[model samples]
Target: MTTQNDAASALLDTSSQPTNLRIAGDWTLANYKALKAQTEALVGHYDGNTSVDLSQLGALDTAGASLLVELLGAQRLGQLAETATHLPAASRALLQTVYCSLQDFCVPEKQPEQSTGVQVLARIGSAVDTLWQDTKALLGFIGLILETLVRVLLHPKRWRMTSVVAHIEQTGLNAAPIVGLLTFLVGAVVAFLGATVLASFGATIFTVDLVAFSFLREFAVLLTAILMAGRTASAFTAQIGSMKANEEIDAIRTLGLDPVEMLVLPRVLALLIALPLLTFLAMLCGIVGGGVVCAVSLDISPAMFISLLQSDIGVQHFLVGLVKAPFFAFLIAAIGCLEGFKVSGSAESVGAHTTSSVVQSIFVVIVLDAAAALFFMEMGW
Candidate 1:
């Protein structure tokens, strides 16, 4: 029901039916309180009549202003016949508009409710099933990679051999000095820590053994690969994201060129070619760094360091470390390129995907190193 009240009237001289309210005063809060009774009288006169006239009401306020609306709402709730009061044109239109809106709100409507515990569990089971299916798809992808690797192995000449060579020359040869320097520094740090403890036990000479064994087997290669993954992987993502934004990739597609083959294949091929070579370089530099520390702190001669390294480290251990590099390289390149393709139409999406690519590639590289370690151990390497 509408509540409209006015306390005073301004237009009462125009002979009007007692049922009709006429006001000439400015419509304000106090006016409606006085006119509420007159408006209610009109509604009572035609309680169930077809229509009621209210056109004579010169003005109305919020309180006595729109009782006709309430009258209509009450009638609709009781399924009673509705009435149309002769209201001023503006007032009639306003009341009718509000009446329509109230009808929509008051009508019964159906709504869906969420399920409880058991249903939630069932939904979770469905999600897990979907994840399992996606995981199977990922495995299928790995199988494809294995198949491609085998094909390339069988037909080395048909493979993108030049691309791989170029990447190796660029990524490995150009990166050699930096990778060597970093590994050397890392080895020095490791040797210092080992020496600090070993000297206390009068076993300082064993620092050489610790540095050689740890770097050759793990740290040197893994650290180099991880650094390259962060550097090269982020570069790949940003490059591809820029190309995607510029629609160059779309242009290639229009020209009947595969973006994957022309773009991704080269980077992937290059990293694979570079990783093993860089890992070998990293190990050499780390050994050199450890030797320097041995000469300075442990008083072990360079010749002795070299001779010990030659005798203690085997080709098999080097191969174990080398074998993991190409795999890590492939992982880095693939994740980076894939995330690049995930870029949307916004610069923000590109930045987010670029960061994700680097982080995911690094995580994958570490996990892969652990797995490789387990595999090599199982093989008794």
Candidate 2:
């Protein structure tokens, strides 16, 4: 009753009794498609009395043995396989092997969900860990810079004067105009505020003292440091990060030159020189802007404002602000160079570290300035 094609491939007998599935024909890869199609809806049909008959089964392979295992269901196959001594030894072995392999197949369990508070706490912990790592990296980089710098300084023949001078022109001279203009505007605003507030108390003349004291001791250095943080810090990171991305830093190392000495030292030296000089210029420009505001708004002449400035604000106040400049410069340059070395050799990494350098430099400058302010206040300087 069977066609030759049906008899050539695997076949499942549906005419058998309800508890029985009879397999026949060659159970090999050549018949896997027809076998799978036949077994799809009939698999997992297990009642306690269910049975399988392989008495008429023909040539078999792993592919067809797997199909037989699925047809009988794994549990019943366990019981029926031991007593299937009438089956071909090879067929019994193949079925046992396939059953053993698939015995553990099962669905996986879903993970439990977490509460929102736990998620937030995890994020906070991650941030704190990241912050601690950054602090350690910054400190380590600072130590390397100092050690390399001292060694280079001792051997003046190895000094990179040309590079240092070029950077000074770039980070200092080029930025002078903007630093002056912006600080001048801020100074004018501060003076106007002081004058307006003092006028109500009939002490408008003391506005000269307010401008001189603020600009000389705080605003001048603070503004210059902040400006350099955004300007110079970003520039250092981009320059060094680009070199890192291009593998130029590796080339420097390959050539037996220290990257910290050849690259970082020049920048740190340039910024150390540049920031203090810029701070001085910022002080002069700020005082001049305040003088201009006083003349226009308070009807105070330039001479009187200068006299009040000289009398009320001593040279000590100027020194107090200037002393903080080198510290801020060193930290900013160190941070930029450190972040630059951290680049993972991609354009996006360069940009990300550049941004990170600027933010860290600014944050560090503000914190150091505040600490310096407090220290100087306590010292009565």
Candidate 3:
């Protein structure tokens, strides 16, 4: 019998047909490094048929039992059953426990190598699949919103007037100053560029018409929608996402309340009312800014700028721009709420979906604006 101070050792006897492997000494964590190296070396010399003799093992523990199991493959445990019966009760129990624990151990299969071209194609396929899934999800969400809107319309009592008013204050009234300021600055820049370009051809007088036409027909609505996509959409996502993360949305549903009617409809209605007003404000500020730039840089008086705009630009341009506002507002609000509903119960999920809402809303607004422009051009509007 070996004491606790004796290091673990294994001896192999290959004189017989099936080799005998003898284990002795303190087979505990204290001698783990030496046991590990010795076990690994012994693995090459043994096979499934080898008979293990653990009867002489001293100071056996879980760690040493695990190494012994590794030296004698777990699959070969049956061959050592009779040998284990001759071991001390403690050593036998340790070996039995380790063997049973490692019985389910399996080597992971290696992935096959792929060529660079194949890998690139695989990534492209995955991206396309993801895009398709996103499109389907968005369409499904739009359908759900439409259904909820119809239900709310049928039930006048379901109209969340207070919530709608609050959102209008949040998404519309609070946003007006920044919207006006940004458009005003953009208008000044457009006027400066137009004045510079037109002066080269001795057509500086047309700069007023350029700014008015661009702002009234496209820039005003497009800029307002993009701003809302970033500002309002992200805000909507964060608001609803927080509610979801806090389990408040779940609690609402548990009480038999439709979250769509309570949360989404109010925001949508607010944006529908607000965007057109904001677009009108943007158009007014932009035109005012352009007129200021014209008066200062092109030697054109405010009177002359107004006269030029009245004579050259049509009312149809402003109408065309304002008509797209409601559509842009609906989509931005829908995307924001949809992404918010997607948020799982985590702060990280709320942040991720909020960012996704902004990106998707911006992308959709731009694409729809471009499509509308093409359609109007084709119709000769």
- Please write out the lDDT profile of model 3 over residues 73-176, one tens digit for every residue: 66565356446676677666666667776776678899999999999999999989987988898889879888999988998988899999999999999999
Can you rank all candidates by lDDT, best first? 3, 2, 1
TM-score of each: 0.66, 0.77, 0.88
Clashing pairs in 3: none
How well is each residue in 1-381 modelled by candidate 1, as lDDT tens digits?
A: 222334344222223333323333434456544555545544533334333333345554444335434543433422321243454555555555555566667656676665698679999999899658744644564465556666656865657767767767766788888899999999998998999998899988788889988888898779888888778888888888988888888999999966766677778878887888889899988888888888998889998888887887787877777788888888888777777776775788889988988887788789888988998889899
Instruction: Show model 2 residue runs off by greater than 4 Å.
Output: 1-11, 15-111
Model 2, TM vs. native: 0.77
The predictions' CA RMSDs to the true structure, in order, are 7.4, 6.3, 3.2
Q: Could you give the candidate ranking by TM-score, starting with the highest?
A: 3, 2, 1
The lDDT leader among the candidates is 3
- Candidate achieving higher lDDT, 1 or 3: 3
Better of 1 and 2 by lDDT: 2
Highest TM-score model number: 3
Quantify all predictions' global Cα lDDT against the true fold.
0.71, 0.86, 0.88
